[model samples]
Target: MFLTLVLVVGVILVWFLVIGGVCSWVWSRLIACSSSWASPYECGFIASSPKFDSFSFTYLSLLVFFVVFDLEISLLLNLPERVVGFSSFYYYFLFLVVLSLGFLSEFFWGYVRWGY
Candidate 1:
């Protein structure tokens, strides 16, 4: 039993060490190959011209909200199989109400616009 535990721990440690080394080498290579220019520029285009556009806060907020909402939906979808009670429905309803409130606030603040 002791030998088995030691072997398992040793294998895990070696696996982590190998993974870390590989990740570090790849990160170093990427950094070395990157250009010195901070601003994004397209090849065959004037470097001085305005290049990459920044995402606005409205778009970012909507993206974050939708991602989180979808994650919540996926988590809740499994609840019916695992849980058997009215409590699950109550929690699901509460979550939907809160999510709706958030959507309303975002709409009022103009984070979610009509025209894409």
Candidate 2:
């Protein structure tokens, strides 16, 4: 028990020391570097024009939707085996059915047309 306690204390002390040192180093570096880092063209790169065209909202919305659904599918895939029984299989089947229906609707609406 004493050995375990000493080991835990030692680990905690080491972790805090390392984290504090890193934080101090990063803070000092940021403070010292900010004065010379504000200009956009500081690294020998010259800006030719003021600005270019902006991104479309449709593309951003589609990207967000893709990310949300991708993360949901990943989480569903990693569910515990004990919790994923026959009901989970049925749930997955229902999800796939809904997804397919949405895809078909989008296809019909020309939202998923091939090529730009």
Candidate 3:
């Protein structure tokens, strides 16, 4: 329990520090601007808009697919390192077949079909 808490806190702290540092560095250039200064300098043009636009469920589903597939591919890549044999190749091929079939099923169901 304590270890998880520490890890979570550490991650949040580092995330905040990195974001704050980058924002501070970016906005620091605006301090020397020659006009009414608030926004980041863009060679004399200041532009602003909503921080986040409208969200889409389709886009969200696509993002989830990307993450899940990426994680699976990463794990698949490690299979060769842990199990070195001809059977490992068979397992890898099987995994790929299953993954492809899963994606096709999702496509047929329109869970990740484009423009759906």
Best by TM-score: 1
Error (Å) of candidate 3 at residue 24 is 7.3
Question: Model 2 Cα displacement at 69 (Å)?
Answer: 3.5
| TM-score, candidate number 3 | 0.46
Deviation of model 2 at 56, angstroms: 1.1
Ten-residue stretch with the least lDDT total in model 2: 43-52
Those runs of model 3 whose alpha carbons end farther than 4 Å from true positions after fitting are 1-37, 40-54, 79-83
1 or 3, greater by TM-score: 1
lDDT of 3 by residue, 1-116 (tens): 99999999999999999999999998887675745455555445446643546678877887888897897889787885874578678877887888889989988887765654
Off by over 4 Å in 2: 1-46, 49-54, 79-84
Backbone clashes, each candidate: 0, 0, 0
How do the predictions measure up, each by TM-score? Answer: 0.50, 0.48, 0.46
* Candidate 2: residue 86 lDDT (0-100): 81
Candidate 1, 1-116: lDDT as tens digits? 99999999999999999999999999888877667543344345666777657977768877898798888879788886965788678878888888889889979987688777
Rank by TM-score, highest first: 1, 2, 3
Model 2, 58-85: lDDT tens digits are 6875886698589668857766654646
